[model samples]
Target: MKRYALQPLVIGALNPESPVSKHRQLRAILRTHAQETCKPGDRLPPERELAEYFDVARKTLRQAIDSLVEDQVLKRVVGVGTFVAHPKVDLQAKLTSYTEEMHRRGMVPAARVLRFDSVPAVGNLAREMGLAEGTPVVRFRRLLLADGTPMSLDDNFIPEHLVPGFLDDEAPMSLYQRLDERYGLILQWAEDEIEAAAATVENADLLKVEIGFPLLRVTRHAYVDDNLIDFSVSVYRSDRYKLFVPIQRHGMRPPRYTKITQT
Candidate 1:
């Protein structure tokens, strides 16, 4: 039999005489356990073992697992076993804080500030920054790092009127954090688009990846109170990063499949 540090909470709440089905109660408890403790890709006990431990029929146990699998909270592999699914991305549009996203993945984060200067914005950059065609703006370039490894390169332009002391201070790991903490720039909302492209020769040299490797490019425009505050272009390494965007469809359920086996 497979062993686990199975918590008592998983089976402690069942009432043999309750109105609820024992299978239902067991399913609820197991779902809670996975949410609170299990890492993505962690495997659960086999169906037979769970059925025996919960004192439920095999059919009942299977039904409970199936429901959770549909919820995207759990997944089963045919030849292996069920596991917690890694996060998935949604095609629907949304905004995200890069700092919070990286920290959640258990990576040590850092950023290298390459250039910080107030210069005359030109062409479309001035328009994006909500300035005159050649208005002065702060241009910044940074290399975002995870676990001391280069993961992405970011370039941003902000109107000088919005961030007064931005160029004076040394940069931090997260520009968003610094904006709110230092300049009192409250970021109300942002719009962004993501796409895939091959790393250019310059990008490959800076990111330490092979030239022409696939990369994820994200372009963003951030705002505060109907005012355009920042515009940025970021490029990320494809091999080192996997994006997870959760989604729910309107009709039929999504398919579930497993990819790993346990010894």
Candidate 2:
């Protein structure tokens, strides 16, 4: 009654006599197609059409799609069809700036400074930076982007006494680069904490994600020896970014401060 066809949706023919199951065979075909022929956000054909073209039951086709979806090779919307998922970036947990990390991946990095102001350090902000309650601090918010895609919203705070006239300084792409090259504030040690979170309304708007989307919350405390220099909290899109941390046993020397390269 109904007919369906695909020119290049799936490559070659499914091996009916092969040892692999039908769904797995279908998955391999789909995977190959997605990798070779399709781009991220490219939607696959309808389930019925795919099932018919592959000459398999709808259940088998659905199973194959589901497997890919779980692997993040594909993503499905409620009313929308399944689409190829965007590639995720793996950022190493080293003393590296966002600009350096993106450059290592052959990506272009940019930042849009939303607000920069001198605020009185109060409450936890004062205690965190080891500054007096009424001390003035530089607070700036930025939207970090990689290849024109929104990646994170970063909020950084620094004691104004340490960086006097910072607002008048030329805006740089990387804060770490600026601190290292200009101020001789090479950070010797730092701490980073990551947690799972949901996108808030404000965050979602900046990050270009739906409300309540999954996010990775990262907080950092960085210092030059005993002097706290920078404290930051960044919210990242989980679907597009991942943290890569290396683990080692004791007796290994602690990681040292890496020199920031000027770009």
Candidate 3:
């Protein structure tokens, strides 16, 4: 409910003679002002006031603000003015559950089990799980949330025989934990492929983002002792999440030989 007053120094005329377009100039100035003066959750001045201060038309001002909103540098509520956005989460490529990762970031993780049922595996599902066609597989469609905000939509397929009673109502937040505790199936490793994607209507509704919004799709195959346990596809909000991978150089040395006199 707190409001932030725009800084007076940001009120200046745009350079018309400059090569940059008026909207682009306005956007750059606003971006700098927001970065320098605005704190996260600080509401920006009203659109009319910003237009007047920048000496630009409302439409031009709107275009500039829209760019920031798309970049997640600013957030606009219907009635409330725009506010600076919080930092995006950096997700590491690790074999940890979503709940564990969120908890490590000091965020409360929650999951809504949208769909949980057993279905016959075919095509890629069968091949990925190394199961015969028509094998019964438990499918989980879940929406993952962090601090009550939608973060990702997960669709997972697991061999049903490996996880008996998993579709029951009393399901744990962390499926890996459940598999380890109840089925003694340890997840030793996983391979993940990450790519950019657009949010589909169904996923956008669950994630609370606009349809066709930018998203990050992650396809994963988890294993236990070289046996596939589950294959999952997760779509994350690109504006809210960033994938991080750490690389290290492997130390190697060519063969070194000493002359016979060195003995």
Please, what is the TM-score per model?
0.57, 0.89, 0.70
The candidate, 1 or 3, that scores higher on lDDT is 3
TM-score of 1: 0.57
Note the residue pairs that clash in candidate 2. Answer: none
Against the reference, the lDDT scores of all candidates come to 0.73, 0.83, 0.80
What does candidate 3's lDDT look like per residue over 73-111, in tens digits?
Answer: 888988878888866765666677778778887888899
Taking the tens digit of each residue's C-alpha lDDT, what string does model 1 give over 157-187?
A: 8888777777777766677777888788878
Q: Mind giving the per-residue lDDT tens digits that candidate 2 earns over 190-254?
A: 88888999999999999999999999898889988888899998888888876565555598876
Top candidate when judged by TM-score against the true structure = 2
Collision pairs in model 1: 88-245, 89-245, 90-245
Name the candidate, 2 or 3, with the larger lDDT value. Answer: 2
Give the Å error, residue 26, model 1.
Answer: 31
Model 3 quality (TM-score): 0.70
Q: lDDT of candidate 2?
A: 0.83
